[model samples]
Target: MYTIKYRVPESARSGQSARSEEKWYHVSILTQYTCTSTGASNKKRLHRKQYCIATTKSSQLENLRSEFGLPVVMDPIGNGNCQFAAVSYHLRQYGIHRSEETLRQEVVTFLRQTPVLGNRICGANWWTSILKQPRNNLSRMSTEYEYGDQITLQAMSQLNNMQILIVSTRNSATTLISPDGSSCLSSRYPLIILGHYPEGAGEHYVALGYKRHALERIVDKSAQVTWETDPPTSDDDLNVGGDDLSAGGDNLSAGGDDLNAGGDNLSAGGDDLSAGDDDLSAGGDDLNAGGDDLSAGGDDLNAGGDDLSAGGDDLNAGGDYLSAGGDDLSAGGDDLNAGGDDLSAGGDELSAGGDDLNAGGDDLSAGGDDLNAGGDDLSAGGDDLSAGGDDLNAGNYDLSAGGDDLNADGDDLNACDLGSPNTSDITRLREMVQFKRNRKHVHQNRHVILPREIWCIIVDIVLKLSPLSRYSLQRVNRMFRDLVGKTPPPRLYLCPSRFGDVTVSPISVRKIIALSGSGSGLVQAIRQLIRHSSWVNAWLFLRLATLCGWYTVEGIWYRRKRRN
Candidate 1:
């Protein structure tokens, strides 16, 4: 129902003729009311074209060509002949015998005779205008499709019982859609459409670069192909695809994929086999494999939980109190036992021995603390090995690898000398006194260091630095934010003078502490420094003191008044 027109500027039309811009006038859509066989209730959308008086130049349609990425040709079939030309172009490609002029005349005939077109039917001139046409030419012209519209195309399609896909182009922003409905129509099956121009000016249409049917994919439905996932699941027969073996019941066999629920004692020899909690046996290379007396062997084997005993090359006895035997093994749950060359028992009260063995939990006793009695690399993380609450004692050359209290009593074979000097019977008593005197210094400073030694050291260094230096260090990271926060400000002098006598004032200490950001403790240190000290120049201190905010005008006034 909406009408869109495009007209170019007069500047671009300087040397252009009427048909010059026709290359840009692509497709115009018009609607006509029609009735169906069941009744007038059924309505259908139709495509139509009108003889647009204005023309559009090719330069104005460059955007359309760039977007669609195809060559464009203006309509050469004159006014009112677009539908016939468009339909004839498609029919000839499909080897249909049809002329463009003949189709145009037929489209005109279909529109004039259509009952729904009513009094304003297309190609039917007024009674007064019809008198000017010659007698024979009047009949052909009335049905000659002076201008083709949507209803004209519909009637032709209904008569031939063929459906056609048409594309209408309006502007540069518009995207060309494919016959399949979502994509651009293949260039092989080219269609005509309107191009870019100013509104209500000139209308233009262009032919696309290719044909539509030539780009369609031809599919053959008669060929037969086999799929691997559809393998048969006969009893004891392996499934080809290895997925969803058998849903009927248990004891159903499948190869390649994992197994779901099945019968008791069902044996699965697949690559990655799995079974329900109920009793089941798997002899697969990997994955879970178990039975009542399950024997599993592979790189990684997991005998599912329960009172099931597993004996294989590699067995992981994950069940409670379950016994497992393999070269490399791991066992979980309480009271679970395992016997292997290299064993790891996780439960409490586990007794295991091997070259590399680990026994966790309380009361885990081994013959010599480690599997290899005198071998290196022995680690026991559990508490209370051997005698309950005693240090876990390993034999000579073997260490209690876990916590220091490997044995509950904190006693171990690796005893450290607690600075107790061992003196021979022949040694003199005087020499021992000398050694004790030297060791006294160590005990005296033992309480000097805080528990957090590293943090205290970094804080002391940061606090001793100058104010500017401390400021730079404080911004290094968030961790040191408070380290330099209480640091004292820089002082005018670094060392005291030796020639002149130095004196300390309570008021100066208070003033310096307030300005230096140092606490009252700094005053005590300053007092101790200047108590017996001497400065090289006494006047230097007085002059620097005033500049350093040590002396104020009020203090000077009070001193002069006291002197007066």
Candidate 2:
């Protein structure tokens, strides 16, 4: 069996950061575990293919120790990579062994300086097959997954210092997290945590470079990617250096699942996820979970524990590269897929005609509830994906939340801009209002963008807000400002009189036009409008009225619904 570890290097380059990241390497050993009432059903040990069996990772790991009769196993938490051993080596080489304390202080200084950002790199988790356990079928009397609750890195973010997972089994899918921020799942509140697979790692991984020879070479070749193969071996030699590390072949060690060779890709620090190959046929699942590049697929079919395909249910890729058909045939039930290219939830609850669809890919469609989000780069989508009560953010561009609750966490957002030539479905209420409004709202306003006709709705909403609010709106985003600037909102959207000052005297309009030209994000220059408007209210309507107006600062229109 093998294990992946990380080591710190004595070095330079200081910036505002600390804590480097480690890579999760797969060190395949025998499986061991503790039997729970749901042992065989654990999904953690299902790969054993033992039916009616129930066990835990602790049990599985033990079982392996017994089978192989090996006493030492690799530990990521221990003196990682034996790097400490090289300290003396370094001293001997530089003739400074006498200054050990100096070296230690130097290392500590490095960790604290601006260069050491607060552990910017942290190991993610290992990817395992979803089928490792008897997928807790949806039929079990005691069910887990529920409605309204989803697995989002953001939602899970509140689960700090914990491990979580979103997986599909036999024909069931669910997301589990440690509610208390402890790494255990509560079968009762499946939402709390998916529980632990026992043997699932509790340590961090440091990323080392991948083994560039035999295995990785072949895997890369299969994907049509070019790479230089060092001391490569032919395909017929799987057994040549398979178990023999000393056989002189560079091995792919992101161990638990094989990523380079279609297995589980290991997790490394720095939020760098080493994923297996996720495709229409297979997906990846995080046996354990952590930060960024948080979830994807495995190398081999389902190696990452995110089984991409629904067991050949049908062709899943819906021409979106991220969409595929997975039949969740349980009556009133659904098939859910969470990983694929360009798939996302827009951080909302997305449900398909079927049931749930969680995706990491984009430009896709689903029939189940979908939620695409994971701080700066999280994408969750599906036919009815709903960011209902959660975050729907696109840390960057070209992100679409096809179902509902399309939102913007930090970036100015485009909700349901799906009616265009190249967008996904705006399935919330099965309508595309936001989709259209986002497309067209860019043009109606003065100096704005005009792409489609639907944007008028947003323009309508923005128009109803107080002038100060409207001005502050520019600070929401540079892109939104740029786009909305091109496509002005519809003039009739708001009653214009709602804000009383929305259509102030002639000179005010020009001032607003000019203000619109100057800002992006959080109250920009328009924030000063609050001060100006407040004084006007004080002089005309009196202090109480001014306070009343200030209270509506979120948007004057928000106080009353926009006109039809």
Pick the lDDT winner.
1
lDDT of candidate 1 over 123-200, digit per residue (tens): 343233334443334355555335544444445543332333333333223332222222222212223233322235
Model 1 off-target regions past 4 Å? 1-64, 67-74, 111-145, 171-201, 209-564
- C-alpha RMSD values across all candidates: 36.2, 30.1
lDDT of 2 by residue, 1-564 (tens): 576563433345597455566654454421232233356575655555444232333564454332222221321112221222122122222222322223333333332332212223542211121232222311221121111122222222231222233221211222323333333222211111121111233222111211225224233333222222333354322222122111012233332554352221122321222223221221355432243333344433333433334334332233222333442222112323343323444543345433354433333443233433212122222223444443333323223444444432222244534444223343332233334434444543548554422353365355455443444556777644542343222121112234344323222322333444435322343344344543322211111112222322222221233798
Off by over 4 Å in 2: 1-269, 272-307, 310-348, 351-436, 439-564
| Clash number by candidate, in order | 40, 152
Local distance difference test, per candidate?
A: 0.35, 0.31
Question: Lowest lDDT 10-mer window, candidate 2?
Answer: 188-197
